[model samples]
Target: MWYLISYVEEALKYIEANYSEAVTIQDLANWLGLERTYLYRLFNSMVGMSPQAYLLDVRIRQACTLLTHSDLTITNIARSVGYEDSLYFSRLFRRKKGQTPSQYRLTHQSPESNS
Candidate 1:
């Protein structure tokens, strides 16, 4: 169990480091030194999904925080979160957030925005 915890921690760190790049399951599995199938099992066992899902969730969560707090443009937000194409980023954000990125930002202004 501890080994798995360490594995998850390492994997998460790698994701954070490389989330800006074009990451794939095979690449992430290789980076973590785990067989793809076993990695999938371990990730699913611990997090209820594969690493890809976790990475996307992390990105979306980060985007949500950025949206509420920052004045960056939508495309900039998308790029900051590893998306080169705002269209795809917007689609992904909407899929996860039920609103476009702009709408999310507009609706979720933070204290900074008030100032």
Candidate 2:
């Protein structure tokens, strides 16, 4: 119980630290010194999603922040968040956020900004 919690915490930290890179469940399990199947089951049981889903969520969340706060091009932003294909990134972003990344940035821009 508590052991699983500790593993989950460590896994989350690793995910956050390496979300910009290409991370996989096997990598995470290897880092934690656990079997991939066990880690996947434990993570899914606790986090309510697969490790891949969690990774995507983290990447998308970071993309949202970069989209709103930085002037980086969408392609660059996508790459920065571990996505190699900007079009796939945009499609995933729209599916998750209900709007294109550009639209999200436009709507979320600061009220005082004139851009």
Candidate 3:
């Protein structure tokens, strides 16, 4: 049981470190030396989400930080978050954040960054 938890933790770390890349569940499974279905089940059981869901969550969270703090264009932000298609990123961001990336930035941008 403890060993399984450790694997899940390692999976989380891997996603955090490589969320900027085009990572997939198959890649994660290969890295962890587990079958794809097994990794998915373990990750979902431990983290309450599938590996792909967690990856998208991480990417969206990172995008939120970039949007609020940097002047990067929407396209750049999407790419920076591992999304090659800006339109798809926008749709996902909207679904997760309840707003478009631009709107999120407008509302969440730090006052200091306005200087």
Quantify all predictions' global Cα lDDT against the true fold: 0.87, 0.91, 0.94
| Regions of candidate 2 where Cα sits further than 4 Å from its true position | 111-115
lDDT of 1: 0.87
Q: Between candidates 2 and 3, name the one with more favorable lDDT.
A: 3
> Candidate 1, after superposition: displacement of residue 105 in Å?
0.8
For every model shown, what is its TM-score relative to the native structure? 0.88, 0.90, 0.96
- Per-residue lDDT of 27 in model 2: 96
lDDT of 2 by residue, 1-115 (tens): 7999999999999999999987788999999999999989999999999888999999999998888778888999999999899999999999999999999989886644345
Q: Any runs in candidate 3 off by more than 4 Å, and if so which?
A: none
Per-residue lDDT tens digits for candidate 3, residues 1-115, read 9999999999999999999998888999999999999999999998999999999999999999999888899999999999999999999999999999999999999977666
Candidate 1: worst-modelled 10 consecutive residues by lDDT = 106-115
> What tens digits encode model 1's per-residue C-alpha lDDT throughout 13-81?
988887877788789888888898988888888878889998999889888988998888888988988
